[model samples]
Target: MSPHAELVSRLRAAWLSGKTRPMEYRLAQLEALGRFLDEKKQDILEATAADMRKPPFEVEVSELSICRSELNHTLNNLGAWMKDKHVEKNWATQLDSAFIRKDPYGVVLIIGPWNYPINLLLVPLIGAIAAGNCVVMKPSEITRNVERLVAETLPRYLDEDCFAVVTAGVEETTRLLENKFDYIFFTGSPSVGRIVMTAAAKHLTPVTLELGGKNPCYVSDSCNVQNVARRVAWGRFFNAGQTCVAPDYVLCSVEMQEKLLPALREAITEFYSPNPRESPDFGRIVGDRQFQRVQALLHSGHTAIGGQTDAGERYIAPTVLVEVQQDDPVMQEEIFGPILPILTVASVDDAIAFINARERPLVLYVFSSRKEVVKRVLERTSSGGFCANDTIMHMTIPSLPFGGIGQSGLGRYHGRSSFETFSHQRSALLRGAGRETLNTPRYPPYAPHRLPLLRAATETKRRATCLLL
Candidate 1:
């Protein structure tokens, strides 16, 4: 057998042996994952910096800290999440114990994205562990340094028999997807999400796709321009704007656009100084291909502020474009870089119409002081998540489920949602053998009187005592 097949077989064997089912084993694995994060803090920071020139502070906050929080949250709530939950039932089922059993899908496959490699990979792994399933993690090959770090170092902290990390590019990933798995969790582009879902269809496997889209930020005139610009600029330029939920473009009135331009220039200068390329907090493009793609977009609209590029260092300045049209190339796809385009709309209604006309975004931001204006936008459009005045802050809360709608992506995973995504809620009903008389109505005995009695008993009503007779 091939190495990949053998690895899957080994994990399947371990799962079949019931080693991963016990609460003790699950807790130990979660604790070990925590230890892995804590022990490899420096290594993770260095690796991410090597792979993408990501600043150490950004790596610590966005990558390491998020994973640690997820691990800690899972540890604290694993028992409560795993416990069999009793569900209310009808009168007929009241005599029986009806509860939902959170059963783990035997083995899971997790495919991580390159942007935030460690967090994307390990966070899902935490959920699979909490759900008591064996896992095979495929870290993105594009982020070579961090991929090597995880493939080499993570297994030592986890049970080799129950968890494995496979490092490869497209060819290997295609082959890996051919194999059967109980569940698959993938975070990447929508085009690739389609491929993952197609492959899983062969085995009838379930999948959760955390894909990307053109997230829209609508700025109303009823808000503070400087505050709005600061929030939007930070969200748009964080990680050099490689974020999936980053505001892809801004939609506002021409008046608001005029006000926002100066404020944005001020915010950019305050955040990254006059020469942003020299700022240590700023990051470069991940590779030459990404650099070239983003470089082509700088020519889309008239550059309002900060349009600088360096091919050798893979640097693109935190840029903002004004007078952009709806059909421009930059407006076409998810601009996974530090390029923010502003398209002018006549009014808030026009902005909502423009947003509703395009593909549903992973996130929608509406900046306004008026509650009614925010309420109007929220009630009209559909998105994976929404933030009234801020950007990318909705995802920080663990209680809110994070996922996409329609083409943006499918399924969600973040706190209890993550555990539930990896689990199958098996409906369980237990009753005494002496309850044979109560079950007679469900048995096939040709009796007209029984039909009326059964229908009346099961129908929606306050009193069911008469039907029982």
Candidate 2:
């Protein structure tokens, strides 16, 4: 049998045996998982570097830090997050306690993505574990080293009955989805997300999709163009532009694009030196396939500056493309590489119109000091979230909901959102005989006197307080 199928069967058997029932055991497993990650920090970094040529420092800051912090957050908050919540009762049900019980959706599946592999996989795992659900984690096969590390390392530290990692490509994923899971958390492209959702619909399994979109950065005339260039350059080229929330493209006036490009070049030189390939601060495209994809996008347009490539090293220089039309392929898709396509527009209003025309992005960034212009953009455009005078910084805050909308993707997860995603809040109420007075009116013995009384009692008003059962 296939490895994915076997893993599913093992998880199913574990669920049947009730291995996920004990809260103490679940918490222990979570703590162990964190400890295991801490113990194997070097191994995680090595594997990530092997997969993407990612720098050691980046592995620490982007992947490991997020993983450790989230695990820590879960460890510190799990008990409280798991505690049953008491809700206020209304007069109709005042005799009984009204509470919200958060129950696990058993046997969850987590499909992790290639970018930030460890963090993407483990964040959802923390949620599923905290919510008391057995998890089947599928690390992205594109990142082979990290996938191997996860499949090998996770089982050693976690209870095989409660948490297991399945590593495979599309065929195995096809087979894995055949067996029903109560919940699935997927992070990837919009194209694959649709397939995941379609398969999930067959089982009616609840899903949380963390997907990507053509995230836009809008530069205005009011801001400091140099500072704007610095932040935008950092966000665009960070992770080799492989981040899902990376500013996919920029919209600004032709004059502004010209103004920003020189500053951006300066910023790039400051961050990674003029020879970025030789600089330790810069990273390469993830793999051959991604390298080729980004390289092809470079050929699609007029390159204003730094159109350099080395396929053998999987390196593309920090690129700036000008005279880029909206119809260009680079502008059409999520340019998940170091290429920054600058689309020139007349004004901020024109930029807003351009943004509103496309699928709503995951995060919208507007760099401007004018409060009225910022407010106008905020009121006009719809995104999963937005950041003012910045790019991709909103994602760093754990309090904000991070997920796409419409064609970009669906559902949000991070911090408390992650806990809520994995657990179903079941509303339950207990009532006593005193509330029985409310029930007698429904035993219809049609009469005129009863109509007036029923209308007076049941009529809902804007200023009236209501009770429930």
Candidate 3:
């Protein structure tokens, strides 16, 4: 038997004991998680830096801080979130209690990606725990140090019986996925998402695939060039552009593209020094393989701004490519690196058509001074999320749901959405035991006299008040 089989059995036994059901128990585990983040601050920073040279500030904000925010938000709202939500009743069971029981799926599996390893892994763990499920967390082997840290340290803080950290490579992970899980949450590429989904189909287990895609950013000529450039640059280059929601390519008119080129150069220079390789603020690509993949994409178009590379260091300077062909290799896949490409469109209609023709992105960005332009694009396109006048900031808000449509991804989770994604809303109703007359409508013996009584008691009004919720 595989090593994880024993581990799965242990968690399943714990979950079956009903130990994870109490609100107090869930709170304690979540609080212990917050302590893990607080105590492991330095460890997390060092681990990510060792793995990818992620800048300290970037780790703190994008990785550590984001996870902390999720933990605290879940802690604050878990009480209300776990309570039985009373739903409106129809005429049939007016006296009966109707509610949605916020029940937890038994034991779940969460697979994290190498990029933003801590954030991606822990964010879903927080939700699974908040929803009162026992979880097995799998950190990516690609980020060795982060994986080691999580495997070694996280279990120390939380209850061992309810949670576990599984460290596995590609083959072991394939073997590991064969076991049954109540639910599975995966974060990575769409190709792997398909594999995970296929594995889940064997057990008929429900899954939330938080996959990545080539997100697009549209720049209208009406916007301020400098502001638009800075926001787009930040979104594209943050974490060295390993971001799943980073603006993959820029779509604008020739005039706007010309204006954006100089402004983007200025923004890149200001964010990272002119010599980005030496700058502490900038980060290196995670691995030699990833470095090679990103370096090859530079061949897509002539480098417009920066294209310097040091293979030994796995460092690629913040790069912007222009005159890029629609069929180029860089445009063919998500540029999960410090590379940005610009492609000119004749008009908004053309831009929308171009985007619509391809797979829907994780998030679609539009920068325009005209509200109608933003509104028009918003109305026309579809993505997991949308941001007007900015890029990636929409995801920082916990109130908003984050996921993709069609090929991009399959589920949404952030704050409340996270809780909802992990939770199973079980419909519940309690009727008085003595309601024999009321129970008769749902039972056998059909008669004319009972028809009017059944209709009055059970049949709902055709057009009642429209519930805004």
| Residue-wise C-alpha lDDT for candidate 3, range 1-469, written one tens digit per residue | 5679999999999999999999999999989999999999999999999999999999988988888888888888888888899987878788889999989999999999999999999999999999989999999999999999999999999999999999899999998999999999999999999999999999999999988788889999999999999999999999999999999999999999889999999998898878888889889899999999999999998899999999999999999999999999999998899999999999998999999999999899999999999998999899888999988888677778889998888988999999999999999999888868667755676777778877787666777667888
- Of the candidates numbered 1 and 2, which has the greater TM-score value? 1
For each candidate in turn, the TM-score is: 0.97, 0.93, 0.97
Q: Rank the candidates by TM-score, best first.
A: 3, 1, 2
The segments of candidate 2 whose C-alpha lies over 4 angstroms from its true place after superposition are 1-6, 16-23, 88-90, 433-439, 444-461, 464-469
Per-residue C-alpha lDDT of model 1 across residues 1-469, encoded as one tens digit per residue: 8888888989999999999999999999999998999899999989988988899988888898888888888888888999999987777767789999999999899999999999999999999999999999999998899999999999999999999999989999999998899999999999999999999999999999999899999999999999999999999999999999899999998999989999999999998899999999999899999899999999898999989999999999999998888788999889999999999998989999999999999999999999999999999999999998999887677778899999899999988999999999999998778967877886886677788778765666766556555
Per model, state how many residue pairs clash: 0, 0, 0
Clashing pairs in 3: none
List, residue by residue over 367-467, the lDDT tens digit for candidate 2: 89899989988999999888899877776666566777887778888777788888999898766757566767656686676776666665654676678
For model 2, what is the alpha-carbon lDDT of residue 196?
A: 95
State each model's CA lDDT, in order.
0.92, 0.84, 0.92
